[model samples]
Target: MTRRTSTSIGFVAVLLWALLALFTVGTAPVPPFLLNALTFALGGALGVSWVTATGGWHKLHAVPLRVYLFGTIGLFGYHALYFSALRLAPPAEASLIAYLWPLLIVLFSGLLPGERLGPLHILGACIAFSGAALIVAPGPDGFTGGIGLILAGLCALTWSGYSVLSRRLGAIPTESVAVFCLATAVLSLPAHLIFETTYWPAAPAGWLAIVGLGLGPVGLAFYVWDIGMKNGDIQLLGASSYAAPLFSTLILIVAGLADPRPSLLLAAALIAGGAGLAALGSARAQRRLIK
Candidate 1:
């Protein structure tokens, strides 16, 4: 199959895995600190081991320490913010808002020396923002649509910066960068102890939750996203990523963390619907080029 088809499939797989991760998080009574640290540590060990087994780890030490610092510290903030938003906001709303990452990337692309936004890029920004608004329209009880909007906006900004910086790293080995992200995220481990708890449930069920996160969402999901995103169209990347939110919210419904509230469901439809349009546009353009 073509790269785009493969990527669409990969994106869907990642979303399903992410949904499982969300359910794990929802069910676990663990504090966020302990949960997030163990979460990254498990994923980090797996990623590092996977790369090392195949000699890919050798490329890592050659990378400047700065790369690790940037990858670790920068990504820590992004993931932290992303997760916090889910804790504080509705799943679907958080996903819709977080997706502004691609639009931010396009905007940053325009500001960067050689990066520039085109008509399609501008179109994407507008569509995505509208979807976000629909998803997070203000509510009360501090679950204010406003709060969700803010948190989601933060995730998008941080992730967008991560994307731009990663692109700037040029042809750096993808696996090496992944190592830096997972390995160095350890810097945030201390925060688990200082700012929050460091231990998870001493139960089989808790361990299982950690495993799903580390292996699936944390380790495997990143690999899929990196492979799909780096090798596929950016707009298609944005559109395809909508799958993650939809799948995640669905999982939340099954877990009862979120009601199948009409607003949340409709908002999800907007994001998914917009994604379909963009994906269709990209496909038609590709077919025309081949023709």
Candidate 2:
């Protein structure tokens, strides 16, 4: 696919992720690891079905074992750190810290071979981060330093690293994400058994939310993201990722789960402006390549 097409596909992941908080809230009382196992199992099943229908089973065999390990670690490690961070630290602060992956993705992409990081990309990422901060930053309960904060930072690093490194593995088929999801599910089941109390979703809405998470955010999102990171405009994707938190908050407000705030308007403007700048930078780079 063309770079533009792949980037658009990648942005779909960002849009899907916006619903993460909403769906997660619906899966209430189901502890994190248990939720992870359930959702990932569904996600893996979704991928397996797609692979079977497409007759792409041969591609899966070609992927190296190390790649599977890498993918599994990326998916499992990120959630493990993120869940632990939230449990130990205040949710707001931990979320803000963990959300640094987008900014880090932009920064880390600069080091990748054949990728150019223009000033606009850096500026846009920073501005977008500020917008995300407005949404996820601490409330009346201010920052308190702890190991959770440290884990949150690592959470950001782990995800950003996973995303950027995926670009180097462009030869790997997107279908390989199926294995990643399944392995994550397997790993999470044991973790849940060890550390979390087993609780099923009490209501149909909760079960629906888990299914939604598996099919959209955790399933198709990862597949498209792999294609995008491998072939699309990484810088633009990185900058645009800030919209996840912005759109997520809007979803909560629309669902009557959160009170509408004036800050959201300003945050929206900043994120839009930043994404615009990043797009302009990508356009410039493309034009340069054409010349």
Q: Judged by lDDT, which candidate is best?
A: 2
Candidate 1 residues lying further than 4 Å off, grouped into runs, are: 1-13, 102-124, 140-149, 197-199, 202-204, 284-291
Candidate 2 residue spans exceeding 4 A from truth = 83-97, 132-141, 144-153, 263-272
In order, candidate lDDTs are 0.62, 0.81
lDDT at 103, model 2:
73
Candidate 1 residue 220 C-alpha distance from true site, Å = 1.3
lDDT for predicted candidate 1 compared with the true structure = 0.62
* Candidate 2 local lDDT, 1-291, one digit each (tens): 898899999999989977776786677768889888988999999999999999999998889999999999999898778766756664444555676687788788889888878988878877876775675555566545378778878988999999999888999999999999999999999999999888888999999998998999888999888888999989878877877756776677788765566765566667666766776786788789899
Q: How does each model score on TM-score?
A: 0.81, 0.87
Candidate 2, residue 23: how far the Cα is off, in Å? 0.7
lDDT of 1 by residue, 1-291 (tens): 466664665565446454643644553556555555666777677777778788896676678777777767655776666666666665656766776665565556566543344555556556666767766554654346556458768878887787666656645665764665565456666776688644556678667777677666655666555555455555456555656666667776787767797777776666656555655655565566579
